[model samples]
Target: MRILLVEDNTALADGLSALLRGSGYAVDVVCDGVSAEAVTATENFDLVILDLNLPDMGGLDVLKGMRARQSKAAVLILTARGATEDRVRGLDLGADDYMSKPFDVSELEARVRVLLRRQAGLRSSAVHYGKVSLDLNSRSFSADGTPIDLPARELGLLELLFLRAGKVVSKEAIMQSLAAFDDDLSANAIEQYVSRLRRRLAPYGLTVKTARGIGYYLDRPTEPA
Candidate 1:
């Protein structure tokens, strides 16, 4: 999963970025609400870990701006403010979840998983399409109930494709989704990943379609019982 972390605390941001990256999440960090708003506007992220107490602008405005532009990315409020009113206000502003400062890293990671699962319409960590299945927790794929081993990047690629099943995903968007703050990926790299993913999924009636001069989309063929 790709995440946008908007926090002003340098230490906290660094720590959380490292932790999330270790967990296989591509994260981009911004120190203020202004950058948060701008990034959320243009970039496609699965989740946003936002701090309400920002330097240039309050995180509330950033959340509001995201909603104003009809962004569907899940927002998780992570700040020192833990009052009921703050929670209610953030929810009303379209936050998917909220966590207070000085929180447990494990709990934060759990909440992030829950929010991501919910956003992807996945009741649990497993996503099923035709005879193909993928377990997010295990980071494993299967075809016809047989285990299929995939590299970390390939697994991430398939996860994104599965979540957006029929929707067209641009190369630029795919690159951003799979890339970490430090990793430099080119368009050809994305094509290679897509090619490998397509081959892996083809036998199970899952196909990745390329739109001329556009992007790719996942297409699932009907499976006979």
Candidate 2:
């Protein structure tokens, strides 16, 4: 999934960005609320990690602008304001979840999973397709009960494909879901990942088909005659 992280602390932003990317998420980071607002207005994101103590604009104002523009992206407020009133206000202003600073990274990851699942209308973290199964929480993939060791980037690509399943996912969308803000992910790199994944899943009776010039989609194996 694509996520926008709005935090001004350079160290914290770098740490969080690394953690989220390692966990198979495409992340873009901005240090101010103005940039956050502009990005949300122009681009699509599955989730937004917003900090209320932004240098330019209040985090609440950014949240309000997104809501006003009818953005459905899940918002998670991350700030040092741990007071009950602050939490209440954030929720009231359309924050889907809130976490105070100095929280554990594991807990933050768990919350992000929940919010993404909720946004995708999914109740389970394990996605099953034909003989393949992937556990997002555990970051494991298996084919016909045999464990498949996929790298982080491949796993992220598979997650996007599985989420859409039969639907055609554009190359741009795939890139957006797997590439970080500063990563130099070219189309050739994407093709390499797709080729590798296609070969890997073929043995499990799944196929990733290219839609000519459009993109790729997962074709589930049919029942035997």
Best candidate, TM-score: 2
TM-score of each: 0.87, 0.92
Candidate 1: regions farther than 4 A off: 144-146, 180-182, 202-205, 221-225
RMSD after CA superposition, every candidate: 2.6, 1.9
lDDT of 2 by residue, 1-225 (tens): 889999999999999998887777889999998999898998888999999999989899999999999999999999999999999999999999999988998899999999998887789998888878877687678877889988878888888888789999999988877776788989899899999998777777888899999999998765423
Clashes of 1: 0
The list of candidate 2 runs beyond 4 A from truth reads 222-225
Candidate 2 clashing pairs, residues 3+ apart or interchain? none
Question: What TM-score quantifies how close candidate 2 is to the native fold?
Answer: 0.92
Task: Give the per-residue lDDT digits (tens) of candidate 1, residues 14-123.
Answer: 99999888877899999998898888888889899999999888999999999999998999999999999999999999998988878998889888888888888878
